[model samples]
Target: MGRHSLPDAYAAQDSGDAPPRRRRTVAIATMLVLAVAAGTAAAAQSGLLTFSEPCDDSAVRLTMAASPDIAPAARAVADQARENEVKSDGHCLYVEVVARDSYKVADSLARGDKDPDYEVWLPDSDLWLDRAKGNGDGVPVAPGDSVASSPVALATVPSASRTLGWPGKTYSWAELVATVMRSDEVRLGAADPSRSATGLLALASIGASSDRQGGDSDTRVAEAAKVLAQRMSDGDAHVLETLALDSSGAEAGNPRRNHAVLLSEQAAFAHNADSAGSGKLDLFYPKDGTPLLNYPYALINEPELTTTESRAALRFMTLLRNEDSRRVLAQRGFRTADGTAGTSVIASAGGRKPQPYDASAAAPPSPAALQETLGMWTITVQSARLTTVVDASGSMATLVPGRGQSRMDVTKASLIQALTQFTPNDEIGLWEFATTLDGAKDYRELMPTRRLGDPAKNGGSHREELAAAFAALQPVPNGATGLYDTTLAAYEESLATYVKGKFNALVILTDGSNQDPRSISRSGLIARLEELADPERPVPIIAIAVGPDADREEVAAMAEVTGGGGYQVSDPAEIQAVILQAIMTAGQGGQAAAE
Candidate 1:
């Protein structure tokens, strides 16, 4: 027989071999030893044999940093695991869950300058994982299974719900948002997209849904974003605080209180559970479909983790996925990873049949699309203060390979188009550079940075004056690129006139390398920028190499010194998108640094 099989002659030996009491005791002892031996053998076979007693020694401790909204549920599961003495490879698991903002954690991870305090990270959305692993230079984080999910939706007080005809009447995300914006009585609020995954996802969904409706969708989305920005909160939890205190929505008249807010389904459920009667919020699941906030389980700096710690982290993730743990999550207003919830969970979150709550989730936006949306939102909300410097070297007159327009013409048109994206509150200036264009100087200021809404000396808005200047820009007859000196001049001026509480930057567009032998050297320019760059008043230089002739590596190295980045475009038309993308990247980096 196998080693696990008992001997057949043991029963025969026990048949009156000793006194009854002694036989009983001996038999009991023998059975106990055999059982333990069998257990030990089984454990050894599974590669989990441990010499220490369970929970007495060899405990595997781990720290988990979870998004604030889902931290409580994760902590509950962790608590239960400790109480039950859950084991990983025969070692007790002791997990500590800490609530941290997903954005902050992502920023820290993206920097990757130091070791993280937590071994595990549970962000509210997988979107944050992409942010944390920015450009593949950040700390190595391996994403595991999603633990829970929540759909993004609009939440409203009773009066506002009645106004929007929630539950009984449904609208697409675009329609719902448009209706909310058009209404004078209803005020909308949201978490800042730059800092909230829920906000960014909802915004992206609105943009996508609006595209389906056609007819100037970009303008419509921008207008909606502006409205939401008026009452924007710092983050998800803070956005809830912006809601009207009165369930009747009478406080809608108060500028500080909002009648509606973009929120997660789980957040609505938690709010409703704590509220009574009409005080509870009613949710609207946009007809186009809602984006889900998938709470992804991630292992931070996995390579740096010990073998036991790594196994324990995964084991805890398994525990979180177990049925009991899922039930605990549901009780706290979270849905399953697949976005399904029980009837009670749905009802608590203000969902009902025919509201499209059961509809399939909207496809996740591409990383590029999400980045663009965030870039747009960042510039819009912060009100940029930019000094745009254009290279007027003769090379800018080169004709495009396909389009009939010259490179200079295309660059101008693209810049003008980009200008439309900025709000009236944004400050903009213009400058042009070439060899000896301004007597002793290689660069000349065309316009001083001022609010687009501010009046110009020409008796029109600064916006119009700037537009005219952009249009009139012409390549000097035989000018050489004075990139290094022009860049240093622009950076110094931008730093000197730094506007507090704005997205300040110096935007430089060039078509070639620095050709003015009299100008500063690239190394000198970089050293000067590094010395002048102030964290207290950040003004990154967004340098774009506009054509094949421009040295991308040269520009990139210089730009990096000022906490900004560099980009190259084969076609001048691509400059518009690149500018916004650069701003988004720089803004996020600056924000992270400040934090």
Candidate 2:
């Protein structure tokens, strides 16, 4: 979803900077009018005098969970409201602004098992809202207007900035990242994409820029992710700690310290404001476009909120949009809600005129694109152990409608393309299934799951062996689909061989439903999977139904039992993307469960 706006009726009234005398006169006149109206209504309603009661006895208390980076500004606004006696419907607004990590809050909301203990959530980006409402199963969160904005950029120490030609020369996101990665002197670091919006947005921008440049963009993006993982931090605050302690880049040679980091403009501003001469950072806003961190104000479980609490929360949001509140935020290095920053803010953030920091913000990446990038990042950071089971039924030989290749041929090609996305450390194995493929069994393992970097009996690496195996896949003549039995067998094997700390999964691809009458029924297979599933050691099945004939609902039901999901792809060529997407989704689910 894009940006959200307040309705006309609830929009904040901009009380401009009026002189003290003018404000006093206006307040007096308003009070006189209110007093007359109250006198007229007092005869009918005795509670009209309650508006004059002390705030301590008549206050609407609200707890707000705000992102740590902007918590200070938010807290300041809340404090000002309390000190100034800001009121919502004659009730003093008392907000408790608690600094909280966005990812943690998102996870808690996603679980939906307990109350969030807060009326509102202010995250660094709207992306977290998607995570909170995953699959429409998490606690409901309604997106409101953004309170502040920050652009994602690369920040470096003085020495690194000079070496990279920061002010004098500009580079596209992909080119800049490639330059830093190739350099032996400068080490690039970032907050983990799965946890940091700045990291994820910057990575997405790089991917988009790479795609614009064409040719092997996926490989380039995957390689960049690998490099970034080497120097990754847990979150935005921690990532800043990874930067060099000194401005000269000498301390960065320690290997643990980074010469440059992917960070937000506001973060850079904060860092610069706290640092002295050498500790200051210079920013590089990618020439392509910078992604913005729009801190969206969201209501948590709005329907459950009492009317008073809801009105108070909206009043707080409206106050946050006021001119005075905007000034408070801008003083703390934040941009306005629309991303307009003053010259001083940009300069303090180490941004110059030539850096293109003022360019229109990049179009927000779609949820699917973000999901795929995150999935790619997850696999890149944590190696995967996958057992791929492909259908070799007679129907696989059917020709694809506009393509000359058979269904099997296109699937193999797609699978091979997917292989290139995995690192050498990842473990992958191959299996082909059909009716009685292996003497009384419906599945036969062509290769045991092993690291791609490991050597094979034939002398080359396991990767080469897997590639050959993938190329050799063909439809079994007159064979029928043996989906149910094969899925259970592969899942059992995968779980039994689960490697701790790795993304272990069973990937099954089929073009049709089970046809073997003697095989285990769908319900039996699902029941067995549910019994074998372990929460502590999750092995989610990424089941893909290929073509129109495949039973999507059947596979979805079976997959859901083991905390996995089933997806359908009308074209075999779509398998690679779906596999990564499923892996990302399954990985996130596993993380939530563990939490």
Candidate 3:
């Protein structure tokens, strides 16, 4: 474990910028605490950091949840503020900062099971602060008062750098990722985006890049990007970790090596700091754009906060913005709150020498767009092991007033385009339904669930088979919609064949209501759906209804219970956008857009 593993709360409580001698002592003391945590003798009362109730007689207490990586710098600043004995309106103050995983804290805040006990939450990125608010129903998340910032970049070993180009060559984020994805020489690794901004930003860049392209190129790049993102979903800081790791444990000349880790610039600084003398990992500043990990000092403003505590919190925030505080943070590899590469980062005792820098950091996408991107990433990049059920009824052949193609033709093109938004490894099958289209069966499997390639299964890959089947699909002229029964049957089959480690969902593209007399009633369908519903084992139904004649209400109801979504499109051409939104919205536990 790096020096950051020890809880900053204890070591930094009163150590106000320790001198060289005291710093070593503090380091040893922290090591002892860590050792005790791992020690067999301390098994009964493990070395977990816990808070003792602060006595209320003399002061106001400011508790903070600091991101684990930067917790040390935060602690140092807090310790100095502590020494100052910051007073607000004659009240003395106490500041306490504990290392907490940003995702876990955000998750807890979203669950509403616990109120954030801290007067402030210092996540490494604003993304967590945004996520913690949970669609704005709960407490409004106060914006981050950024105390520090870092840009998401790639960190690679020297050997990989030789192949991918070094500090002199500038590659756009798209060009850079495509190079890594197309080859097996060096595997690109990313932090699980749910836990850290590093991986999230990488995947978002890929999605945005693909979104900019036209036609089949968009689909091809997106599918490939998703595969890369999934392959690189290592836990937080895996990128930095990979820089030092080797299976052979060989240092520089070994064949065994990790290629690249999409990470924050600060992380690269930290890793290079850790390995000062040898094997320095290099940073890659993307040419196109990058998302910054702005370490916002977001105040926890609750109605329950005491007036004195609020004042004290403001005072604490002011202290953090001071030169001394900024200096402490900058020395530890973070950019100053304003985001400049001050000499402090290079001049600090263990800091790595500064590398070539680029200033074209991209502005964050709109809040809705960011959420959609995140939702898209969570669903499509992680991917669904889905079985698509398309309506093959006579109504699907109805031609529109303006659009040139039949509903089925537009629907086929849309489905094909949507497939580009998924990983090639994601298992998918095609099924078409209408009453008695295949003798007594309302639905018939056109392609069995398999991986993308035909050879992935005994006969053919799901991707090739489904694409061919969809292209050849013709609406049965005499067929009646089999909405309810087909959904129930499909849901059951999907549930039974659910693959582990895959986001499971059923994509239903329909044009009309259940007109089959033999089909189950809406009430019966809902009851069966209720029986199958499980948040623990979710298989959402992403239903898209085209044209005004489609039964959207009933289709939406089925989606609602199964933790999916129902969408209505005036044009079959709009099916692409609706399906995209449906899948993205459904991926995030179906947090639908506000109606």
| TM-scores, each model vs. reference | 0.65, 0.67, 0.63
TM-score for model 1? Answer: 0.65
| RMSD (Å) of each candidate, 1 decimal | 12.4, 9.2, 12.2
Q: Candidate 3 on 1-595: residue-level lDDT in tens? A: 1232222332343244222110111011122232333543232122232234433455678898889878888888878755765444344557888998888877777666446678777888777876887755554344535667777777776656767767567676777777876766666777766677777766677656556654433334445446556555456745455454433346433333356778777877777777744356667776667677777666564445665565456556556666677678777888765556565453321223233354646666555656655666566566467788999999888887688788998888888876766556777889999998888889998887777744744475667667778888889988999889999999999888877667778889888988988888999999999999866668889898888898789889988889888888888777665665566567655432221
User: Worst ten-residue run, lDDT, model 2?
Assistant: 21-30
Q: Which ranges in model 1 have alpha carbons more than 4 Å from their true place? A: 1-56, 247-250, 386-425, 428-448, 451-595
Model 3, residue 45: displacement in angstroms?
A: 44
Better of 2 and 3 by TM-score: 2
* Clash number by candidate, in order: 0, 0, 3
Q: 46-77 in candidate 1: lDDT tens per residue?
A: 33455555575678899999999899999999
Worst 10 residues of 3 by lDDT: 20-29
Task: Report the number of the highest-TM-score candidate.
Answer: 2
- Candidate 2: residue pairs that collide: none
Candidates 1 and 3 compared by TM-score, better number: 1
Clashing pairs for model 3 are 453-461, 454-460, 454-461
Error of 3 at 444 (Å): 3.7
Q: How does each model score on lDDT? A: 0.83, 0.84, 0.68
